[model samples]
Target: MDNAKLQQHAIAAECFVEVPFFDLDPMHIVWHGNYVKYFEQARCELLRKIQYDYPQMKASGYYWPIVDMRLKYIKPAKFGDKLLCVATFKEFENRLKIDYVIQSASSGEKLCKGYTVQVAVTTTDFEMQLVSPPILGQQLHQFIQAQ
Candidate 1:
C-alpha cells in the first residue's frame, strides 16, 4: 500500500531514552552520531511489534540491511536530557521505510527527524530482494486488520 493508505492504519512504536554523558560532545551536547542509536532503539520496537525484526529476518533466511538513511537536526539535546523517540512504519513493500521523530520527553520539543530504508537480501547468496518477504505482508495485513 502507498504511504497515504498506510497512514490511515498507523503502526508506530514509541520509546524513551536519556542522553548519556558519554554520548556528549565536548560542548556538552549529544553527539550527532548518537541519534542513530536512538533511532535504532525505536526502530527495533516497531519491528518487533510487527514480528519482522532482525532475528525474525534471519530466521526467515533474509537480511534486511539499511541501505539509505538521513537525519535532520532541529534542536540539539544535552547530556541528561530525556528523549522520546517515535518510529512509524512508512513503507514495507519494496523496502522497509521507517520515519522517526525525537523530542524532549517532558516538554515535547522536536529535536530531530529522519527515516531509514532497508531492503532485504537472501542470507545464502546475498541477492537483493525486489519484493518484501511474504511474512511481512502477512503480518502487516493482520496488524492493519486488527486496528
Candidate 2:
C-alpha cells in the first residue's frame, strides 16, 4: 500500500477546550503533557464516528493501546484560552496511527502537532499483532469507500 493511500484514510474531528488553570505550570502556560489528554479526546471521537472505539475493539476480542506517541509544541496556550484540536487517522492496517493538530481558535496559529500509534493485541493471549484483523480492515475500507 502507498503512503498516499494512507493519507486517504484521514478522519478528522474537532473540539474546543478552555485552558483550565490547573493545567498551567509555573510558567503560566498550559503544561505540555496536557496535550495528550486533548489528543485522546479528539482521537476517541474520530474512532467512535467510524463505529470502532476502544470498547468495540475489546469486545471484538482485541485490545489497542497507544504504544507510541510524539508531540511537537509550536506555541504555548495560556489559561482560559480556547483552542481547537483536530485529530485525523493517518494509518490503519498492522497498526493504528492518528495525527493531531492543535491551533488557536482566535488567531488560527498552530499550537502543536502530534501522532500516536497503537497496535492490536489478542485479549486472550496478549499476543501482538503483525497484521491487522480483517474486521478492522473491512471497517476502514467501508468507511473510506463511503467517503
* Candidate models: Cα lDDT each: 0.91, 0.86
Q: Which stretches of candidate 2 lie over 4 Å from their true place?
A: 1-4
Sliding window of 10 residues with minimal summed lDDT for model 1:
1-10
Could you give candidate 2's per-residue lDDT for residues 59-114 as a string of tens digits? 99999888999999999999999999999878777788889999998989999999
TM-score each candidate: 0.95, 0.92
What would the per-residue lDDT of candidate 1 be over residues 37-137, giving only the tens digit for each residue? 99999999998887778998899999999999999999999988999999999888888899999999999999999999999899999999998888787
